[model samples]
Target chain A: MHSISPADFAAILLSLKVGVTATILSLPFGFAAAYLLTFKEFRGRVVLDGVVNLPLVLPPVVVGYLLLLLLGQNGWLGALLNAVGVRIVFTWRAAVLASAVVGFPLLVRSIRIGMEGIDDKLIQASRTLGAHWYDTLVTIILPLSFKGIVAGSSLMFARSLGEFGATIIVAGNIPGVTRTIPLAIYDYAGAPGEEAMALFLCLVSVVISLAVLVLHESLAMRLARRREP
Target chain B: MKLAVEVVKSFGVFRLAAAFSSAGDRLGIFGESGSGKSTLVNLLAGTMPPDEGAIFLDDECLFSREKGINVPPEKRRIAIVFQHPHLFPHLSVRGNLLYGYKRCAPENRRIDLESVAGILKLEGLLERGVNNLSGGEKQRVAIGRAILSNPRLLLMDEPLSALDDELKFQIIPYLKGVCEEFGIPFIFISHSMTEMRLMAERVIVFEKGRIVQQATADQLARLRMPTSQVGYINLLKLGPPRQVDGLYAYSWGGGELLLSFPVRRPDSLIELSSKDIILFKRHPEAISSRNLLRCRVVATFEAGNRTGVEMDCGGERLIAEVARQAAVELEICAGGELFAAIKASAFRELG
Candidate 1:
């Protein structure tokens, strides 16, 4: 194999950085959404649930375009942010936002399953035992559904690593600032006489995804065993 | 605990409208499944709010639709022991017990973990995980956890209904003893008449979302004797027995009674069905039955097809059921003398 170029190395590092940053940023909001969807009763709950799950079913390109419109330079939110001198479009932050929005439903769905599996009686027992709602949420709900959180985070991170359509439209294909592994691969595939480099990056993607899935499976098994024994 | 509840709650087709007050230290909510007993418990514990009306615990308003006063379960200080143990799987036995104790307010914290563990006989299992404990031990830990909260009232919602007969009786002592020792009043809920008799002094019976009866457990038992499949079980507490000619003889109120079941425990409870006792006009010359007592009838009540004769033999009370025709032929009356015979195999040890 040909020695890897510096630009490719930067792409690889940025892919991992964006994946990690997106997953971390989405954790609290994901948990909150899952908690509300699973436990709370309110008006328009079904509507809120439908909205949360929209990005999962929508095409990635359409999601990217919708996000572009929402955070464009002349958009309301973008203009408000510009008043405070902060830029989000065509930057690494835009890549993070795009990845987060696309992967959010998966995160929320996984955590919601975990939260739903918890017996209602356990929550009632905690309350009658003198735990306030927030106290019970922190002590009981959070710990009991931690496996779901971990699984969701891992799945979302893997999804973010492969983000393409959204990242290209929102973050653009900058060499070091915004281009990730997939974008780099797309660039190499288009250029003549760069098949080997593309194939090598493809191999790297396969390795990273496999490692994450295997780690996720092993962590889940370990959690199940610890809970039982 | 003095609880006054007048609440109405509905879930689709089933509606619960309960209104009652209880001041007893040990109160039993007796009802069959789907009788709204659990709904009443939820309302009392503040885990579920009532659609209308109010609830007062010792005259302190816990919930009131008119006043817009609805105290949450935590602030109500009313703990519950659910049918299943429901212990936190991540926590050890000690952690589960202290989960409530740590949350209790300082001034309201009267029972500590040590005392709860000691009372529930959970000292050795404290460090062990809750998943590994036996069913009875898990229930003991649950009761201990509830007690450690130092709640003003503990609602035990069929805590032992999930256990087998032997385990049910074994945990009854811990359930009763823990509450008594801590001076925490509790409402015991169960469908088992035996459990109600053993645990609660006064019972509020529920039938189809309504309070049908509120009376002593014994009175309720007698009232249902004609209809119950097991007619009026007479619970007898006897001391350790001595072996006599292949029979176990335990002292009664002031006399001796022979039973076939051997009881190793120092104090044991035995049940004898009312139908097991036979009445005779005079002492027979020879009989297969072992116990023959000279007794005077204290009272006579009409059971379904037979008459229940309340008799006093050697200062102890025993009810002997006889056919109405035989009662009339034998001239069975409140002040008449009669002879009662019971076989040695008739007694069954309960706990």
Candidate 2:
């Protein structure tokens, strides 16, 4: 850590911050979309599912380009935010937004699969026992689906760590603010004979992903054991 | 408590049209699967709504098309115990019990946790995790949890179906305590005739999405609601302890049944399993059946794999389920005279 350059350290810190913030910001929306898709019987349910998952199948560059068109300085939303002196485009917040959009489908998919696996009888039992929907969600749905939710959050954080295509176009490569690990690696790879630095950043990304996955697995194992008779 | 249901619901080719009002506290609905027993219970629980009809409980409309009144389940003060326990996996047994108990309106909280736990014998299980409980233990906790909620009406959808015979009988007394002791009204749904005879104060027979009849067991039998499917339940008439067959005897119909257990209560109802009754052409000489009565076949009906011979002894009506081959060999028919031999152990006393 002492031998690492200041630019490399900034890239690592910024990546962690952006990845964590993006996952936190998207958690509510991800859970809501997944719950709606899994439980509710409504018109256009298929369309809602498809829209939530669009980011996963769409190209990252297209996602970034579309985000740019919608949030650029001259863009309507951009102008609205600009008039309030709040800039979301080409800033650290923009990095978080880009990561959130790109990682949302994975989060929702995992949570939805978990929620779908729960017994419908349990929900009915809760209702018959005088629990409202919100009470059931808090007492039954959320706790039982925690495994999938945590797994999804970890996956989204890892995805955000490696995000480059969308992050570059929208958040830009500002060193301290938005130049995360992937952007830094991209910069190193582009420079003449900076192969060693780029390889080091790639190794760091792999380690971070492994660490997150390990944490999730251990927590899931503990939960499994706790549920055992 | 009173339940008045006049509901019509259709799904695909299946249709359910039932209208009945039972003032009895312990009511049982008996039917085969696909006979809409579960569907009717779901309707009562407020989980499933009727397509077109009205449901009322003590003048308060639970569901009505014209009134535009459909009360949600939680507010209906009705609770259900399913075949499976359906305990919250996230909560401990105590937590699950308290969940409903705490949520009930304070003024209406007649059923408390301690009393329920005591009745259901859920003492040691309070702190255990719900997922870690045995099947029978889970069911006990489930009953306690539902009872603790202080529901005006309880629906049991084969709650003991998942248990073994030993566990099933063991838990039956607790159910009696719920009705007889606590005075809570409940509707139990099952396909088992024995269970109905044991639990039902008023028996409702359902067939193919409709309630065919609703009456006491004796009335139900006399009504001839397919006696083959539902066995005979007789109210036992106790006499002073007599050393008959070296055991205490109780008079049933024209004959006396010697029992290992002493019959003290005159109100005890006993079920005679039709499958256990044996028909003989003659009085039969060296057999240990102990009780035999001269019977004349009142009616006969085909019951799928077997023939049902309804016999009349004095005023008692007993349906003996006989195999088709046996019925043919024995030359059993309406108005035929035969002796019905009941093993001393065949009598199951229910109080």
Candidate 3:
């Protein structure tokens, strides 16, 4: 029955944008990493897996600091990109990048499990049937693991929507620009007479997380049915 | 078309050294468990590289150690179906059938979806999701998928080994028709002699990572080898001339015989009932049957419901199966001379 303030609405839209952008940007890399980890046997596989999982174990601020070091103007990659007139720090895009980095571990882990659950014989059969490696991956492996991909993406989106620490450190919570729902909630909770708005945002976050969980469960059930003889 | 493969591989303690060549013919690999039959299939499929060897398809070198040429599976155009049907779980039966079909060379596509479906009896299953298929249905779809790819060779690694006998029987006629229609060289791996008899034109017996023998189906059936810690039975093959002077000599064993009715061409392989043969302590006269051999029992062993009596008759070794009760009633024992009376028609030739 209560109307949302302009600021609160902008924060919700910003959160959606950041979450969707983060999920889309991270998907290809997540799939590649997961596929490599699941199918390839290499000398540095353990190291690669550990590195991809680092964001999960490290403090959010530490991930943000690492991102800053890599994307900062004077940093190696940052300088190269700056010379091309590209900027990532302290921007909405930077928020998306931060969210992606923090959410990548979950996506890659889920996708890896999905890819590993596939029958290797299926892939071999495809190959013998004249499909090249890439064709087999695209047509056989990816489609067969669709539920896993959906589940991973949904979890990543939900996680990115709630991202606070890494986003604050990297994009700096600028109002009407980089500030997301979680950041807005933090700001409103700090100000007097903003309790109602903060509660509303919190409730929205809960709803989104619940929706994702339900979607994941349904997808898993469908997959289970598909696997039944 | 011909396939020549010679490969040697070692996996920790398991070693595999397989070598064989076939000229557009079906070759069956026979062995017990752990004999590396599947390993040979994998190597030929190009799924795994052999430590040393060469593989040639006709004149093309698929894999050659001396030349360092190893064509990947995709380029080899050889399709393999594993013991477990590996249909794509996410695809419908039709989609699975087309998955490989689309990737093959357009000009090389010799088999169409309709023909493949007809061959495997997959037309009714085209719209169904692969996940809901029964084991036999899955295998049929898998075979259909492979055939649609227009592969030069088809590798079946115990494709029926996972199914029950009834299901196997149900699908065998379809498989036979496919082979006859296409004349595609097949390398079928199986431990079941019955399956080998049905599917393979030639048999290659494997023992301990090596091919012990390679012969035609008839020769393999007649081969007498030491059975593995178990009893060995030599199969007697009976050709045409079902009636020779009103006496059809079906099988001569242990100087004994049983009468069998004449069967038309291509009868199902029958397991001759050992109990059917009647053993007489003395040669019986006035019998209409013509086959009667005198022999002495060399060994007598009781097996489950029947006693296995090994007898030697005029340079021929025979095994007669007699019920325990009959053995007791007749007092049949080792070193006892007995007249084995078998009707000319009782011999069932097994290939």
TM-score of each: 0.97, 0.85, 0.81
Candidate order (DockQ): 1, 2, 3
Off by over 4 Å in 1: B303-306
Clashing pairs in 1: none
**Per-model DockQ against the true two-chain complex:** 0.79, 0.57, 0.55
Every model: Cα RMSD to truth: 1.7, 5.3, 7.2
- What is the CAPRI rating of model 2's predicted complex? medium
Interface RMSD of each: 1.2, 1.5, 2.4
Q: List runs of model 3 lying over 4 Å from the truth.
A: A1-4, A214-229, B224-268, B273-351
Model 3 Cα displacement at A183 (Å)?
A: 1.6
Residue B340, model 3, lDDT: 75
Better of 1 and 3 by lDDT: 1
The per-prediction tally of clashing pairs is 0, 0, 11
Cα lDDT tens digits, model 3, A68-172, are 888898879788989999998888988999999999999999898889888889889888988888988998889777777888899899989989888998898
Model 1: fraction of the reference interface contacts it also forms: 0.82
User: If ranked by TM-score, best first, what sequence of candidates would result?
Assistant: 1, 2, 3
